[model samples]
Every structure is written in C-alpha cells, then in structure tokens.
Target: MQPVRRSSRLTRNTISAPETAASSSRKNSRKSSQRRIRCTPPPEDSEPEVESLSEENSSEEEEDMHEEILPKETRYENSRTAFQGLYQEKPDLLRPSKKPLSARFLTQGARERTSTVADAGLLYTVCDSDSFQPSIVREFVANLGDAEPRGDGVAVYVRGSLIEFSPSLINTMYCIPHCEEDSSWMDEKLDKVCTLLSGNRIKRWEDMSSKYLTVTNQVLYKLVCSNWIPTMSYTAMNAERLRFIYMLHLRKGFNFGKVIYNQIMRMAENTETEKKRRIILPTLIQQVILIQRNVPPDNSDEAESDFPKLVVKDKKAGLGSGVDSKEPDLEEDIDQAISFLKGIRSRLKRGEYPIQRKNEDSESG
Candidate 1:
C-alpha cells in the first residue's frame, strides 16, 4: 500500500513541470515581438519633418556655393569703392601726385577676330535687345585677347561660356557701310573708339544720364572728351574746367562767339577777392581749344593753294568791330596740328599713305 501512494505523487509533480516550461516559452516570444516593432522606422506622420530638414540643409549648401562663385571683377569693384570712401576722409591722400589707378582693361579674345561690320552689328543688337543705359555703349573694352584667323572660327568667352562664331555667321548679323578706305582701317578706328569709350576708368554716361540721346552721338561725345584722360583735380583744368569743356564738346548747336564771350564775361565778373583765390584753366586745355579753333574747315578748292585768302572780321560793330564767323585764332600748337593734319590728308589723297621706313627702303632709295 505505501509503494502505490509514492508512485502517484511522482506522476503529479512531472505534469506540473511541463506546464511551467510552456508558459516561460510563450512569455519570451511576446518580448521578442515587442522589440522588433520598436526597432522599425516612425509612422507616416513624421515623413514630412524628415524631408523638410533635408531640403533646408540642401538650400544652405547652395547659398554657400553661390558666395564662393562671385566674379573677380565684382570683388575688385567693391574694393575700389571702399578705398574711395576711405580716401574721402583723408583729403591729403587725394593730392594730384597720388595717381589713383587710371583704368582697367577687360576684353575677350574673340573680339579681335570680329570684323568692324560684325562689331557694329553686335553693338546695335545689344542696344536694341536690352534696355541697357546709353552710357554703357561708351564703356571701354578691358580684356581683348588674341583672335584666330579668318575661315576658322574665333572662340569668344562671354556670358560665362565659350562660343564659336565663324566669320560668315558674324557677317550675317549686320552689313557694314562701305567707305572709300579699306574696311580693315575703318575696323581699327571703330575698335579704338569703342575701347577708349568703354574703358573701366570712367563709369558709362548712359548709366548716369536719364534722358534719351542718340547712341552714335553719345559715342562721338565720349571720343571728344577723351582728351581729358587724367583726373582734373591734379591738373591745371581743375574739376570745374574739365566739366565745362566736356559739356561744351557734348552740347550741340551752341554759338561759339556767344560761348566764348560768356566765358570771358564770367571770369571778368568775378570779384577781386574771388579772382585772387581762383585757379585757372591748365595750359593744355587752352592748347586744345586753340587747336580746335585754328583747324580750318576743309576747302577743296583752296586746299592745295600756298596762300589761301584769310578773311578777318569783327563781331561787335561794323565800324570798330565786325563779326568774323570763319577764322580760328592762330596759336603755336594749333598751327602745328593744323599743318600736320593738312600734310597727312594731302598724302592720303595722293595715294601715298606713309609707311614705316625700313632699312632696305632707306638703302635702296
């Protein structure tokens, strides 16, 4: 009876151990499933936030890149402005001897390959297509580079890219007017004029002026004023005289007699006190004016004559003074320039254009 009771108790203990092992296995599986869910990405609601952050980072990087790519010219211009401001506070630094930088050159290599007709056309196209100020037309070419020969296209670097325009394509843009002289000579003159006007030394007039002015006339005016190349503060002309001269050259249809009289009158009217403190026009300005006045108008009939009749008249009164509309006062420099130009023109008309004399020519002739 005792053996039978002990066997039944052992059976009951074995059944309870199996139930405990099964429960423990089920609990471990539940914990593993919970961990798997937690390890995964967030829900759809958070996607926008993640993308927005990425976009913001990208925008910041783009801005940084833009700042790095600013042009060298822009940096130089800013520096120059800053320097000018600083110089203003220190007047002594502006003394004439302190030769502030004169001008900068900025032209492209392809410009050299362009024919005069092409250049004129391109310039006109730019003027028509863009609402650029008229003064911009007068600005100088700064960085002219070498051009390849005809037939083979020239490479132009503009608008931040390199482009090739063959001579034929460029010629199609505009037909240049034919002149009696070689077209190449005209091309050289046009290029020179364009370069001087567009040079970086002076800001373009169109940028400064608001009204409408003919592009060709404005270019012509720039050529006339180019005589005063240096800053007037240090020269005998002074700022005022230079400005006056520039205006006089640019203004059209003004009576020369009245203008000259008015100028003299203004000087005379100045008080003794003011006259004592006043600075006068430079000898160079006087020389330039004198030269312009003395240059006789082209007279084909009298051109070759050794003694052309010089008509002298006075302006104020017939008895004491007769107005002489035609003669220029003969100053030494003006006479010299007039004589030189006359000789040059004569030689050119005679089909004997002067060429640089070589040692061979000297020896043979």
Candidate 2:
C-alpha cells in the first residue's frame, strides 16, 4: 500500500536538464544544415547554360521589337521628306503697285482702248503691296495640286480641299467676261504679236527689246508685264507673253479669265521644277486673300472695296495734279531694277531663258 502512494511530483523533478539540452542542440543542427543547403551555388557548367539561355531570350525579344518599329519609322521619314520637298521655302511673289499709273503716261487712244477691255481693269485694281503674305502664298502653293478637269470647269486643291477656279468662277469674282473657248496660240498669232510690239515684221522666235517699243506701247507693255505675265527680263520680252498684251490691246473676245487660270497653272508647274524661280503673279495675292476669307464670288464687292480704285489722272489736270509725271524716282527705280536682276544671271546660266537673236527684218537695215 505504501509503494502505490509514491508522488508524481517527485518523478517529474527527477527528469535531467542534460537531456533537454541535447534535444535543443539536435533541432539547432537541423536548422543550420537547411541554411547551408539553401546558400549553396549552382555547378559552374549549369550557371553558364542558364545565363546563356536568358540572354538569348532577351536578345530575341529586342530584335522582334526593333523589327516591328523599323517600318513605321522609315515610312514616317519618307513622308516627311516628300512633304518638305513640296513646300520648300516661302515663295517670292511679285505684288501689284501701291499707286495707279497716271493716265497721262498713256496716249489718249491707248487709254480709250484700255478702258474698253474688262480684263485690263484688273491691272488698275489697287492692291496693298504690303498686305501680300508670302506665308499664305507658300501654304497655298504647297497644297495646290495639278489642275483636274471637272465637268465644264477645272478644279484644284486649296489647303487640302478641292475648289473650282473655272472661267465662270473667275468671271464671277473679277467681273470679267467668260469665254467658253480658250485663246488660240498659233505661230501666226505669235508673229502678229511680235509685229505689233516691234512695229515691224518679226518672227515668233525673236526677242523684242523694250527700246524698240513705242512710248504708248512701252507703258502698256510695262503694265502688262508687271501685273500679268511677268518675266525676270524687263529689258526683253517673250513672244508668248507679248501675245497676251496683244490680245488686250485689241480688246479681243478671248477669255482673259481663262488666261489667268492657265498662267497660274503654268507658274505652279514651273515652281515645282525650278528651285530659284519666283512666282510673278501679282494678282494672285487678291485671289488668295479672297480664298482665305472664304468670300464667295457672288458677293465679293465688300471684300473688293479693300483695294483702292485705280484713278487715272485726267489729261486736263496734266502734270500739276500732284501726280509725279516724271519717271519713277531714280533711286527707287534702281532698287527695283537691282531686285529684279538679282539671280537673273544665274537663271539665264541655267538656260531658263535662252537669249534669242533679234529678227533680221526687225533689225534696222
């Protein structure tokens, strides 16, 4: 009975501290082994293989991305170059005179004849020479496409949009008569023009110097050359351009509106091919101003009034009308001449305008 009464507390106290320390030391060794295993490096050969595989995969991804982006970049570059070539620089545009030429400069007969031709009035329509915006002209020229035949009229692009500038539109805008037929430019017509300008039998291929022109014709010639079919060489005029002046001189029924449209197309074509050529259409500024303002041809009068009326000094007022009847200020004339002559020699060297011999018949015998 006394043996069964042995205390459980005494049995628990008899467990040794040494055995507990041994169990804890075994757990600490197991944890240390795990740390060594996790910290171990891969075998040398295996490391190279893994690194190579990752590098190859990354390189392939980069190559694929580059291939995808190359075409878009190339296409963008090509388009930008083409657009730049088309626009180039701001165009050198010839503008209209700020002041009207005195009627006294022209003969009485010449004045009467000029009054009869509706197209000639366009020259007298005063344009603010300073108002001409080269930037706008350049933009318009950049967007202008080749003229396309549309129904009875021809259409061209203006600021990326198609606009019809047919004879009807020209007539409506400028109040000039429209002709269904274009002017005939036969060799005979050219010869006739040369004859008229030279006051002698002349060939179409010959160049007529300004010195040979009559005083009245000289004034008309300058007006026509300056405002209409302008050329760099004022000393000598082209036969083709002379024909236009001839037509105006006769008050012929040919369509001057169509002539203007044709000249615009011709100038545009020339600009694309020739790098240094200047746009010599003064009247074009008016057309562009109308277009930019979106002024309809039907109601352009309000817009038209912005241009001063070209008043011709009456013969009765003579030189005393405060209009300087003398030749244009000498210094101003020299400046203009120098400006016109600039780059002309270079242009001639490029064969833009070949020197033509005077006709044997036209030459004084």
Candidate 3:
C-alpha cells in the first residue's frame, strides 16, 4: 500500500511542473509585446519626420551653393563698372605715350588682313587731326539721348532736331559694311587668342605681355594697342580691347557697325553719369556732324600737304622721343597720327597692297 501511494504522488508532481512552465512562458510573451509597443513609433509619424529632415538638409545645401555663386557675379559686374568710370576720368590714359603710334609700321600683309574690319575707316580717319574735332565730339555726346533698348542705335539732338543714328545711318556715313552675325562667339575666341598669343593660359589682362609674342604678333599687338583699340595701359591690355584685336585678326564676320554705335552710346552714357564731358572716336562724331550740316570735308589736298612728316629718320630717335616726351596731349597725338596716315588712301587706291585670300582649308575644318 505505501509503494503505490508514492508512485501516484510522483506522477501528480510531474504534471504540475509542465502547467507552471506554460503559464510563465505566456507572461513573458505579454511583457515583450508591451515593451515593443513602447519602443517603436508608428510608420506614418516616423516616415514624415525623416522626410522633413532630409528636405531641410537639401535646402541648406542649395542655399550654400547659391551664396557661393552670387557674390562672384556681383563683384565682377561692379569691377567692370568701376573700370569704365576710371578710364572715363582720364581719357589720355588710353594712349601708350605722348608720341603717337604711326600706321607706317603696318605691313602690306597686315593691312590686307585687317581690311575686313568694318570700322577700319575710324582708325584711319581718326588719325587726321582736322577730322577729330573734340569740341564737336563733346557737343554731340552732351546732346545725346538715351540708347535704344536693342543696342543697335542712339539718338542725338543736332541743331534742335532729334536725329536717330541707326546702324544703317552709321553705315551710310562711314561706308562700313553691314554684318548680321552674332558677336557671342567672341567670348569663346578670347580664350583661344590668349593661348595663341601668350603660349600659355593667361587669365588676367595684366599678365599678357608683348614679350611672350613672336615678332609678327608683336607688330600686330602694337598696331592694335596704339590705334585699333587704344586702352588705359599698354602693359596691361583690357580684355575687351584684346577681344577686338582678335576679331580684327581673324577677319571674321561681326557687327562692327553696332559695336561702334554701342561704344559711342556708352561714352555718352558715361558722360551723363559722371557729369563730365569726354570724347572718343572724335572723327566718327565729326562725320556725323558734317552729314547733318550737309558739308563735305574741306581742303583735303591742302590739309594733306600741310601735314607734318612722320618719317622717323632714326628708329632709336623715335623710341627716345616717346620716352623723353612730357605727358601726351590728345591734340598733339592726333596731329602726329594724321601726318603719318597722309597719302595712305591714295596708296591703297593704287593697289599697292595685295588682296587677302581666304583660308579654304581652315574654313572647311
């Protein structure tokens, strides 16, 4: 009887142990589920918060980029404005020295190559002192009205009449050919010309020097610096002047009429802003006035004969004169230039210069 009772007790103990284990497992599962609920937020709330953070980060990046770019553009524009103003204040700064640069040094090849320039007349015409009447230039500039929005023209008051000088009118007066192509390509050409002239990538205008140029290029450079696109400093050529030289050198199609008109208008605008009387391309202004007055240039032959000779008997003497001369006066420079260009027109008419032929291979390529 004692042994059977002990066996029954053991079986009951084993059955109770399994039931306790099952109940403890159920309690632990419930606690784990509650902890999970407390730790994790809902998907709808979590996703939006993450998205907002990402958007804020992206916006900050964009702002940073914008900030980096805007000031550089603004500063460049400001510097250009300041530079223009500085040149206006001191017009004589445009010439290299007191002694004028003579066109006699230009080779026949140079003349032929640059003949395509529409405003080449200005270069020659302005050289004649009688043609460059500063008083008339100043008068025209003073009476000039606002420039046309298209930048193709400007209006000036002549003899109490408002005369609009369009590109066509300018062409008629100067005998410049019309060009229809855009000048935007000039920007790309600037880099190419810099590399070609300097034999290295030159970013600053101050860094570009005649020392880096070949003999042929040096002559071309001096010709442009002295006559074509005279600037404030010969040592440091203006980028715009350099670009103009490149255009002339390439003999490419560009709207030179518009360029002349725009430059005149810009000078006028500068005068208005600074309340100062200044003139550039005086011969151009003289032509416009003569056309308005219906008067032809007088004493052409006599004027040519009376012009002083610019023949530099000694090359060293010319150089020494330039170095020793006092501050250059505009009138004196114009007189010298005029004397130098005398009889040039007759020479050109006589076919003394060879015609410039186009480079077919270059064009094709």
The top-ranked prediction according to TM-score is 2
TM-score of each: 0.17, 0.43, 0.43
lDDT of 3 by residue, 22-114 (tens): 999998987886675465665674445777898999999999988777677889999989988989998777665544335542456554534
TM-score, structure 3 vs. true: 0.43
* Runs off by more than 4 Å, candidate 2: 1-130, 146-163, 180-182, 189-191, 199-207, 282-365
The residue-by-residue lDDT of candidate 1 on 1-365, one tens digit each, is 45668778899989899899999988898787666555667656843577788899999999999978979999899999999998998977756554334323123322332332133333332222212111111110111133233354443332233333343332233232322322222122322222232232223221222111223323323322322222222212123222333333223222222222233334434534463533221222222222223323233222221321222221221121112222233584488899999998888677674463355467889
Between candidates 1 and 2, which one is better according to TM-score? 2
Candidate 2 global TM-score = 0.43
By TM-score rank, best first, the candidates go 2, 3, 1
- From the highest lDDT down, the ranking of the candidates is 3, 2, 1
lDDT of 2 by residue, 183-221 (tens): 564233554565666555233323345555554556555
Off by over 4 Å in 3: 1-130, 146-152, 162-164, 198-206, 214-230, 275-277, 294-365
Model 3 residue 129 CA deviation (Å) reads 6.8
- Clash count for candidate 3 is 0
